[model samples]
Target: MRAGRLRHRITFQVPGEVQDQQTGEMVSGWETVWEKVPASVEALSARDLIAAQAGQSEASGRMVIRYRAGVLPMMRILHRGDAYNIQGPPLPDPDSGLEYLTILVAKGVNDG
Candidate 1:
Protein backbone atom coordinates (compact mmCIF):
# COMPACT_ATOMS: atom_id res chain seq x y z
CA MET A 1 0.00 0.00 0.00
CA ARG A 2 1.13 3.50 -0.78
CA ALA A 3 1.83 5.77 2.16
CA GLY A 4 -0.18 8.58 0.58
CA ARG A 5 -3.37 6.50 0.62
CA LEU A 6 -3.40 6.37 4.39
CA ARG A 7 -3.96 10.07 4.84
CA HIS A 8 -6.82 9.82 7.26
CA ARG A 9 -6.48 9.26 10.98
CA ILE A 10 -8.74 6.94 12.94
CA THR A 11 -9.15 5.54 16.43
CA PHE A 12 -10.05 2.03 17.44
CA GLN A 13 -12.10 1.14 20.48
CA VAL A 14 -13.01 -2.14 22.06
CA PRO A 15 -16.04 -3.12 24.08
CA GLY A 16 -15.66 -3.32 27.82
CA GLU A 17 -17.78 -3.77 30.88
CA VAL A 18 -17.89 -1.19 33.62
CA GLN A 19 -19.79 -1.02 36.82
CA ASP A 20 -22.52 1.53 37.19
CA GLN A 21 -21.66 4.12 39.82
CA GLN A 22 -24.97 4.16 41.59
CA THR A 23 -26.42 0.76 40.84
CA GLY A 24 -23.20 -1.19 40.83
CA GLU A 25 -24.37 -3.13 37.86
CA MET A 26 -22.13 -4.03 34.99
CA VAL A 27 -22.81 -2.07 31.83
CA SER A 28 -21.28 -2.18 28.41
CA GLY A 29 -18.91 0.58 27.45
CA TRP A 30 -16.12 1.34 25.02
CA GLU A 31 -12.44 1.71 25.80
CA THR A 32 -9.93 3.24 23.50
CA VAL A 33 -7.58 0.61 22.16
CA TRP A 34 -5.61 2.65 19.69
CA GLU A 35 -5.74 6.33 18.83
CA LYS A 36 -4.43 8.49 16.03
CA VAL A 37 -3.76 5.50 13.83
CA PRO A 38 -3.20 6.27 10.19
CA ALA A 39 -5.90 4.89 7.93
CA SER A 40 -7.88 5.31 4.70
CA VAL A 41 -11.61 5.59 5.02
CA GLU A 42 -13.76 5.03 1.98
CA ALA A 43 -17.50 5.33 1.81
CA LEU A 44 -19.36 2.87 -0.31
CA SER A 45 -20.86 4.10 -3.55
CA ALA A 46 -24.55 4.91 -3.66
CA ARG A 47 -25.34 1.79 -5.61
CA ASP A 48 -23.42 -0.39 -3.22
CA LEU A 49 -24.93 1.25 -0.17
CA ILE A 50 -28.41 0.79 -1.49
CA ALA A 51 -27.78 -2.82 -2.32
CA ALA A 52 -26.40 -3.49 1.12
CA GLN A 53 -29.34 -1.75 2.77
CA ALA A 54 -31.71 -3.85 0.70
CA GLY A 55 -30.02 -6.94 2.01
CA GLN A 56 -30.24 -5.68 5.63
CA SER A 57 -26.49 -5.40 5.88
CA GLU A 58 -25.06 -2.56 7.89
CA ALA A 59 -21.75 -2.23 6.07
CA SER A 60 -21.49 1.26 4.61
CA GLY A 61 -17.78 1.80 4.24
CA ARG A 62 -14.29 0.37 4.48
CA MET A 63 -11.16 1.51 6.30
CA VAL A 64 -7.68 0.43 5.35
CA ILE A 65 -4.67 0.59 7.60
CA ARG A 66 -1.18 -0.78 7.77
CA TYR A 67 -1.08 -4.39 8.83
CA ARG A 68 -1.51 -4.92 12.56
CA ALA A 69 -2.47 -7.89 14.66
CA GLY A 70 -5.39 -8.28 17.14
CA VAL A 71 -7.98 -6.27 15.22
CA LEU A 72 -11.30 -8.01 15.56
CA PRO A 73 -14.88 -7.71 14.31
CA MET A 74 -16.11 -6.55 17.71
CA MET A 75 -14.06 -3.40 17.60
CA ARG A 76 -15.36 0.06 16.70
CA ILE A 77 -13.68 2.71 14.61
CA LEU A 78 -13.94 6.44 15.26
CA HIS A 79 -13.20 8.82 12.43
CA ARG A 80 -14.10 12.47 11.99
CA GLY A 81 -16.59 12.34 14.86
CA ASP A 82 -18.44 9.34 13.44
CA ALA A 83 -18.63 5.93 15.05
CA TYR A 84 -18.42 2.89 12.83
CA ASN A 85 -19.09 -0.63 13.94
CA ILE A 86 -16.88 -3.29 12.48
CA GLN A 87 -18.80 -5.63 10.24
CA GLY A 88 -16.39 -8.55 10.23
CA PRO A 89 -12.82 -9.61 10.91
CA PRO A 90 -9.99 -7.64 9.40
CA LEU A 91 -8.96 -8.94 6.01
CA PRO A 92 -5.43 -8.70 4.70
CA ASP A 93 -4.67 -7.40 1.24
CA PRO A 94 -5.03 -10.30 -1.16
CA ASP A 95 -2.08 -9.31 -3.31
CA SER A 96 0.25 -8.48 -0.45
CA GLY A 97 -1.16 -10.12 2.65
CA LEU A 98 1.22 -8.44 5.07
CA GLU A 99 0.91 -4.94 3.71
CA TYR A 100 -2.42 -3.72 5.04
CA LEU A 101 -5.78 -4.59 6.53
CA THR A 102 -9.24 -3.92 5.11
CA ILE A 103 -12.00 -3.57 7.66
CA LEU A 104 -15.68 -3.42 6.78
CA VAL A 105 -17.54 -0.84 8.84
CA ALA A 106 -21.04 0.52 9.39
CA LYS A 107 -21.56 4.16 10.21
CA GLY A 108 -23.91 5.78 12.75
CA VAL A 109 -24.01 2.75 14.99
CA ASN A 110 -23.61 2.37 18.73
CA ASP A 111 -20.08 1.51 19.66
CA GLY A 112 -21.00 -1.04 22.28
Candidate 2:
Protein backbone atom coordinates (compact mmCIF):
# COMPACT_ATOMS: atom_id res chain seq x y z
CA MET A 1 0.00 0.00 0.00
CA ARG A 2 1.16 3.54 -0.63
CA ALA A 3 1.24 6.19 2.05
CA GLY A 4 -0.85 9.23 1.34
CA ARG A 5 0.15 12.83 1.67
CA LEU A 6 -2.13 14.95 3.89
CA ARG A 7 -2.48 18.38 5.40
CA HIS A 8 -4.82 19.63 8.14
CA ARG A 9 -5.58 22.44 10.51
CA ILE A 10 -5.86 21.46 14.17
CA THR A 11 -7.95 23.74 16.29
CA PHE A 12 -7.71 24.02 20.06
CA GLN A 13 -10.22 25.49 22.46
CA VAL A 14 -9.08 27.64 25.36
CA PRO A 15 -10.95 27.32 28.63
CA GLY A 16 -11.26 29.89 31.38
CA GLU A 17 -13.75 31.43 33.71
CA VAL A 18 -14.96 34.95 33.09
CA GLN A 19 -15.26 37.42 35.91
CA ASP A 20 -15.65 41.15 36.41
CA GLN A 21 -13.07 42.44 38.85
CA GLN A 22 -14.63 45.86 39.13
CA THR A 23 -17.70 44.62 41.00
CA GLY A 24 -16.49 41.11 41.77
CA GLU A 25 -19.22 39.81 39.55
CA MET A 26 -19.19 36.51 37.73
CA VAL A 27 -19.47 37.17 34.01
CA SER A 28 -21.49 34.79 31.90
CA GLY A 29 -20.27 34.58 28.36
CA TRP A 30 -18.60 32.27 25.94
CA GLU A 31 -15.10 33.06 24.81
CA THR A 32 -12.96 30.83 22.67
CA VAL A 33 -9.80 31.16 20.60
CA TRP A 34 -9.17 29.02 17.58
CA GLU A 35 -5.63 27.93 16.76
CA LYS A 36 -4.63 26.36 13.50
CA VAL A 37 -1.88 23.70 13.48
CA PRO A 38 -0.55 23.00 10.07
CA ALA A 39 0.90 19.58 9.33
CA SER A 40 2.50 18.18 6.17
CA VAL A 41 2.96 14.56 5.31
CA GLU A 42 6.66 14.07 4.63
CA ALA A 43 6.89 10.29 4.66
CA LEU A 44 4.76 7.27 5.46
CA SER A 45 5.77 4.09 7.20
CA ALA A 46 2.78 1.75 7.11
CA ARG A 47 2.46 2.33 10.84
CA ASP A 48 2.95 6.04 10.96
CA LEU A 49 2.54 9.21 9.01
CA ILE A 50 5.92 10.92 9.04
CA ALA A 51 4.85 14.51 9.29
CA ALA A 52 6.86 17.71 9.11
CA GLN A 53 5.66 20.35 11.54
CA ALA A 54 7.59 23.20 13.06
CA GLY A 55 10.73 22.00 11.25
CA GLN A 56 10.55 18.52 12.71
CA SER A 57 9.28 15.05 11.94
CA GLU A 58 6.44 13.82 14.14
CA ALA A 59 4.99 10.36 13.78
CA SER A 60 1.21 10.35 13.52
CA GLY A 61 -1.01 7.38 12.80
CA ARG A 62 -3.81 5.36 14.24
CA MET A 63 -1.81 3.99 17.17
CA VAL A 64 0.47 6.94 17.68
CA ILE A 65 -2.49 9.26 17.68
CA ARG A 66 -4.67 7.05 19.87
CA TYR A 67 -1.96 6.76 22.49
CA ARG A 68 -0.63 10.25 22.16
CA ALA A 69 0.47 11.57 25.55
CA GLY A 70 -0.61 15.12 26.17
CA VAL A 71 -3.54 17.48 26.08
CA LEU A 72 -4.91 16.46 22.71
CA PRO A 73 -8.47 15.56 23.55
CA MET A 74 -9.68 15.96 19.99
CA MET A 75 -7.97 16.14 16.60
CA ARG A 76 -9.25 16.59 13.07
CA ILE A 77 -7.64 15.34 9.86
CA LEU A 78 -8.67 17.42 6.87
CA HIS A 79 -8.11 16.36 3.28
CA ARG A 80 -9.69 17.17 -0.06
CA GLY A 81 -11.83 19.80 1.61
CA ASP A 82 -13.20 17.34 4.13
CA ALA A 83 -12.55 16.94 7.86
CA TYR A 84 -12.30 13.75 9.88
CA ASN A 85 -12.37 13.95 13.63
CA ILE A 86 -10.13 11.40 15.34
CA GLN A 87 -11.20 10.24 18.76
CA GLY A 88 -10.78 7.41 21.32
CA PRO A 89 -7.65 5.85 22.78
CA PRO A 90 -4.51 5.18 20.74
CA LEU A 91 -5.15 3.06 17.68
CA PRO A 92 -3.62 -0.37 17.48
CA ASP A 93 -1.90 0.10 14.13
CA PRO A 94 -2.32 1.16 10.59
CA ASP A 95 -4.95 -0.44 8.46
CA SER A 96 -6.06 -0.35 4.85
CA GLY A 97 -8.23 2.64 5.51
CA LEU A 98 -8.58 5.87 3.58
CA GLU A 99 -7.54 9.27 4.88
CA TYR A 100 -7.97 12.86 3.74
CA LEU A 101 -5.84 15.79 2.56
CA THR A 102 -6.37 19.52 2.89
CA ILE A 103 -4.71 22.87 2.35
CA LEU A 104 -3.46 24.47 5.53
CA VAL A 105 -3.09 28.18 6.06
CA ALA A 106 0.27 29.83 6.70
CA LYS A 107 0.62 30.28 10.44
CA GLY A 108 3.02 29.79 13.32
CA VAL A 109 3.47 26.61 15.32
CA ASN A 110 0.99 25.34 17.94
CA ASP A 111 2.52 25.52 21.44
CA GLY A 112 0.03 23.29 23.16
Candidate 3:
Protein backbone atom coordinates (compact mmCIF):
# COMPACT_ATOMS: atom_id res chain seq x y z
CA MET A 1 0.00 0.00 0.00
CA ARG A 2 1.17 3.47 -0.77
CA ALA A 3 1.55 5.64 2.32
CA GLY A 4 0.80 8.81 0.40
CA ARG A 5 -2.69 7.64 -0.51
CA LEU A 6 -3.55 6.72 3.04
CA ARG A 7 -3.70 10.28 4.29
CA HIS A 8 -7.15 10.14 5.81
CA ARG A 9 -7.31 9.33 9.49
CA ILE A 10 -9.99 6.93 10.58
CA THR A 11 -11.07 4.95 13.62
CA PHE A 12 -12.27 1.38 13.72
CA GLN A 13 -14.92 0.31 16.19
CA VAL A 14 -16.80 -2.79 17.17
CA PRO A 15 -20.13 -3.24 18.83
CA GLY A 16 -20.02 -3.98 22.54
CA GLU A 17 -21.83 -3.41 25.79
CA VAL A 18 -20.80 -0.45 27.91
CA GLN A 19 -21.98 0.72 31.27
CA ASP A 20 -23.98 3.89 31.34
CA GLN A 21 -22.21 6.13 33.77
CA GLN A 22 -25.27 7.85 35.24
CA THR A 23 -27.78 5.04 35.08
CA GLY A 24 -25.45 2.16 35.75
CA GLU A 25 -27.09 0.17 33.04
CA MET A 26 -25.49 -1.69 30.22
CA VAL A 27 -26.04 -0.12 26.83
CA SER A 28 -25.00 -1.23 23.41
CA GLY A 29 -22.37 1.01 21.96
CA TRP A 30 -19.24 1.10 19.85
CA GLU A 31 -15.91 0.26 21.36
CA THR A 32 -12.84 1.66 19.75
CA VAL A 33 -10.66 -1.04 18.27
CA TRP A 34 -8.12 1.25 16.68
CA GLU A 35 -7.78 5.01 16.70
CA LYS A 36 -6.18 7.44 14.27
CA VAL A 37 -5.44 4.73 11.75
CA PRO A 38 -4.40 5.91 8.32
CA ALA A 39 -6.66 4.93 5.46
CA SER A 40 -7.91 5.92 2.01
CA VAL A 41 -11.61 6.69 1.72
CA GLU A 42 -13.32 6.92 -1.65
CA ALA A 43 -16.93 7.38 -2.66
CA LEU A 44 -18.59 4.87 -4.92
CA SER A 45 -19.60 5.92 -8.38
CA ALA A 46 -23.14 7.12 -9.12
CA ARG A 47 -24.05 3.90 -10.91
CA ASP A 48 -22.71 1.76 -8.12
CA LEU A 49 -24.51 3.76 -5.47
CA ILE A 50 -27.80 3.43 -7.34
CA ALA A 51 -27.38 -0.30 -7.73
CA ALA A 52 -26.47 -0.82 -4.10
CA GLN A 53 -29.42 1.18 -2.89
CA ALA A 54 -31.73 -0.65 -5.24
CA GLY A 55 -30.62 -3.91 -3.72
CA GLN A 56 -31.40 -2.58 -0.24
CA SER A 57 -27.74 -2.18 0.53
CA GLU A 58 -26.25 1.03 1.80
CA ALA A 59 -22.71 0.59 0.61
CA SER A 60 -21.60 3.89 -0.80
CA GLY A 61 -17.97 4.24 0.06
CA ARG A 62 -14.77 2.25 -0.21
CA MET A 63 -12.04 2.59 2.39
CA VAL A 64 -8.63 1.01 2.14
CA ILE A 65 -6.26 0.45 5.04
CA ARG A 66 -3.30 -1.63 5.97
CA TYR A 67 -4.03 -5.30 6.57
CA ARG A 68 -5.29 -6.05 10.07
CA ALA A 69 -6.73 -9.20 11.51
CA GLY A 70 -10.18 -9.54 13.08
CA VAL A 71 -11.80 -6.83 11.03
CA LEU A 72 -15.38 -8.02 10.62
CA PRO A 73 -18.50 -6.81 8.89
CA MET A 74 -19.99 -5.74 12.18
CA MET A 75 -17.24 -3.22 12.72
CA ARG A 76 -17.65 0.41 11.71
CA ILE A 77 -15.40 3.25 10.60
CA LEU A 78 -15.31 6.74 12.01
CA HIS A 79 -13.99 9.57 9.89
CA ARG A 80 -14.31 13.26 10.50
CA GLY A 81 -17.08 12.64 13.05
CA ASP A 82 -19.15 10.61 10.56
CA ALA A 83 -20.05 6.98 11.25
CA TYR A 84 -19.85 4.49 8.40
CA ASN A 85 -21.11 0.95 8.72
CA ILE A 86 -19.04 -1.80 7.23
CA GLN A 87 -20.99 -3.40 4.37
CA GLY A 88 -19.25 -6.75 4.32
CA PRO A 89 -16.13 -8.58 5.38
CA PRO A 90 -12.80 -6.88 4.78
CA LEU A 91 -11.17 -8.08 1.56
CA PRO A 92 -7.44 -8.60 1.28
CA ASP A 93 -5.34 -7.72 -1.70
CA PRO A 94 -5.46 -10.50 -4.27
CA ASP A 95 -1.79 -10.39 -5.15
CA SER A 96 -0.37 -9.79 -1.69
CA GLY A 97 -2.91 -10.52 1.00
CA LEU A 98 -0.78 -9.07 3.78
CA GLU A 99 -0.44 -5.68 2.19
CA TYR A 100 -3.84 -4.04 2.56
CA LEU A 101 -7.59 -4.45 2.94
CA THR A 102 -10.50 -3.05 0.94
CA ILE A 103 -13.64 -2.43 2.94
CA LEU A 104 -17.06 -1.45 1.72
CA VAL A 105 -18.76 1.09 3.96
CA ALA A 106 -22.00 2.99 4.15
CA LYS A 107 -22.54 6.40 5.71
CA GLY A 108 -25.41 7.43 8.01
CA VAL A 109 -25.93 3.91 9.27
CA ASN A 110 -26.09 2.97 12.93
CA ASP A 111 -23.83 -0.04 13.03
CA GLY A 112 -23.81 -0.17 16.79
Leading candidate by lDDT: 3
Please provide, for model 1 over 1-112, each residue's C-alpha lDDT reduced to its tens digit, 9 standing for 90 to 100.
Answer: 8999999999999889877789999998888899999999999888877786754377889899999999998888999999998887888999978889998898876856
The superposed Cα distance between candidate 3 and the true structure at residue 12, in angstroms, equals: 0.9
Q: Show the colliding residue pairs in model 2.
A: 66-90, 67-90, 79-100, 79-101, 79-102, 80-101
Off by over 4 Å in 3: 47-57
Task: List, in order, the clash count of every candidate structure.
Answer: 0, 6, 0
For candidate 3, give the lDDT. 0.88
- Pairs of colliding residues, candidate 1: none
- Candidate 1, residue 19: lDDT: 79
The lDDT ranking, best first, is 3, 1, 2
Pitting candidate 1 against candidate 3, the one with the higher TM-score is 3
What digit string (tens of lDDT, one per residue) describes model 2 on residues 1-112? 1222214444433334567678887675323334444444232353333343443233333212121223233434433343333333222334522232222222223222
Compose the digit string of candidate 3's lDDT tens values, residues 1-112: 7799999999998889988899999999988999999999999998877776755367889999999898998888899989998887888999979999999888976756
Weakest 10 consecutive residues of candidate 1 by summed lDDT: 48-57
Off by over 4 Å in 2: 1-6, 18-34, 39-69, 74-86, 90-112
Per-model TM-score, in order, reads 0.80, 0.25, 0.85
By TM-score, the better pick of 1 and 2 is 1
Alpha-carbon lDDT of model 1: 0.88
